[model samples]
Target: MGKAWLPFASYNLWSQFAPPVGQERWYCDMKRGYAKVRKREPEVTAILAEDTQPQRVGLLAQRGVYEFHADAQRLANDDGLAQVSQILRLEQESHGVKERLNQILSKYCENPILLGKRIFSLSRGDEGVPEPIRIRCGNYAFHLFAAIDCIFLEPDGTLHILDFKTGRSDFDERQAFVYLLAASYLYPQRRAIASFYNLELCKWSEPITATASQLNAVRIELMRLAQRHEWEKKQYRKNPVDFERIFPPNPGFQCKHCQFNRICQFSTREIS
Candidate 1:
């Protein structure tokens, strides 16, 4: 017989389970319930299909960077920004998206961050579902999905994992830690660091690194999160009606921005 599949964990799941520092007031467990547990439901599936404005901007910004670095000449050419805009078909996007992307692309053309580094990998950001990193913590085994945006080697030989941001979202150190942990497994021999860069704000976070013990602690925490998430999923499957009980809601003003607000009965706002 085949072995049983392990539960999965990612920074996305971690954020859903627990909000970033200072954002606790807006955290809602029911949102995770809808987005992860009952996502296969038609109503939920429909809502999840559409990307929010912020999400669109972030994806396009990352894609713009990818396209710029794809061809080195684009970074040097005077009309590089315009060329990439045409390639992205920026005209098709909404005004907000187009304007934000134009700024991001223009800035990247002016200063391509990865220009001189020996890049190990750079994702276009639309690649669905990165290959999972199998992790075994104590008796628990689970998959760790980390979609790293970019990785390059420093002159000193450290592997640097760089995550890109678009909007005003704060840099979640947990995400950098997760990438550091993933790097530990992927490049067991190489020392690594991780950081975030906000394209819109032209901001860069200080590099983040973790020791062996810290990475192990992160692994254990993810294992626990995976087990808890799987348990919640099983409970919901056993009794669909008990979803709210299993994943209680904290409806408030934030629901207006929640992707699942349209279908969530507990949502505070009446999303049109």
Candidate 2:
């Protein structure tokens, strides 16, 4: 028989369950339910399909970097940015997207960070649904998804997992830890470290490392969260009327920015 499907966990899922440091006021569990649980619904799917401006900038920036590195000479050539822009079809994008992408491409052309590094892997940022790493914790089992942007080898032979950023969002250390945990499984023999880089701002975060105990704790926490999430899903399926009770909403000014505000009954904004 085929293997039984298990619950899944990721940094995204963790963030949905709990707010990041200092952003608690905007936290809303209902958003999670709309996004993850009932996402297959027509209205929800339509909203999710639309890539916000920030999302577009991030994706294009990552693709720009990938294209630059794909052709080593582009880093040094004066016309490299133009060539990459053509490849990206930047003209077809909105003015904001085109302008921001041009800035990112220019910055990368002037300072190609990965020019000489021994790149292990780099994602173009458009790959959908990375393969899950099957994780077994005691009697519970769940899948862990860590879509790392890049990986390179350090001089000391350590594996360096690098995540790229584009917007003003703060670097959530939980994401780095998730990547480190995945590395521990994918490269058990090698020491691994994770860090974040804002491609737009050219900002680099301090390298993050974790001990075995810390990783174990994260694993257990994810296991519990996965189990709880699965239970919530089952409850919602059994009684759709209990949706609000299962995933309570925190409607406020933040609802204006929520993608599902139009469909959310608890949304503060008028749906006219």
Candidate 3:
């Protein structure tokens, strides 16, 4: 099988290179756990969906936002928000999700669509946009890929990449930067502004801009990460069955939220 393309590996420095000293077993457990679910295990997805309800609601709301604006008739439909809000109610979640969706619509409804595409765009173009833009670049080298939440092309030809966050979890600025970097590669001619919108807090992040120099730095880092990842894969291949000696685990606080914890052999007491 081909090696996996791990985008998060770029930001997670600790687990990227190797396991922490004397934690070989933990690394093996982590690797094994990931292997079992590499093909989208239904149980893992269901468990994760349950754990991240706010995120699910946020994604649904985002889709509603795109559909509402895409269809002129949707403007008059008072039930646009309510239709999406119904799922949250069925889940017995608080009214916060419904309120947050309204807040996001109110904030973005005024903007015109220069380029209309779904949440993620795999290919980039100024015209004839497609839904679900899945960015799959650097295939020969590192295989960088990402599904963007949304991309807006302003009248001035500037690109706005907005990622919606519904949960109260702290936003990782790196995620936005990674998307921005991908946008830079996909649309080099246009300048881009990337930000995070916290629907729960009804707050917008200060926009971050990316220039040619900044994008070049990102490219260099990605190349280095790709090389390192390949090296790790080679190490694993040396002893495929002996993951304990090849890919040791680094069990710690992060394990609590890890989807593979149930399958993890490592013992960690840090469960919040």
TM-score of 1: 0.96
Q: How high is the lDDT of residue 130 in model 2?
A: 88
lDDT of 1 by residue, 1-272 (tens): 74457899999999999999989988999989989988888998888889889999988888898998899898888888888899899999999888888888888777788888899999998999888889998777899999999999999999999999988879999999999999988999999999999988889999998988988888988998999999999999999989999999998888898888767788888544
Give me the displacement of residue 270 in model 2, in angstroms.
Answer: 5.6
- Candidates' C-alpha lDDT: 0.90, 0.91, 0.55
What TM-score does model 2 achieve against the real structure?
Answer: 0.96
Give the winner by TM-score: 2 or 3.
2
Q: Give one digit per residue, the lDDT tens place, for model 2 in 1-272.
A: 75567799999999999877978877999999998899999999999999888889998998999999888888888888899999999999999999999999888877788889999998988899888899999988899988989999999999999999997878999899999999998889999999999988999999999999999999998998899999999999999999999999998888888888889899998533
Can you give the lDDT of residue 43 in candidate 2? Answer: 91
TM-scores for candidates 1 onward, in order: 0.96, 0.96, 0.62
Write the residue-wise lDDT of candidate 3 on 1-272 in tens digits. Answer: 74554433343342334344454444444444344323265655555445344554666556655555555555556665455345334346456655655666554444423225333332221222222223343563444554566776666767888876665655666666767877766777778888877655666788887666776666566567656555655665675565555456677876765555675566364566
Q: Candidate 1, clashing residue pairs?
A: none
RMSD of each: 1.9, 1.8, 7.5
Candidate 2 achieves a global lDDT of 0.91
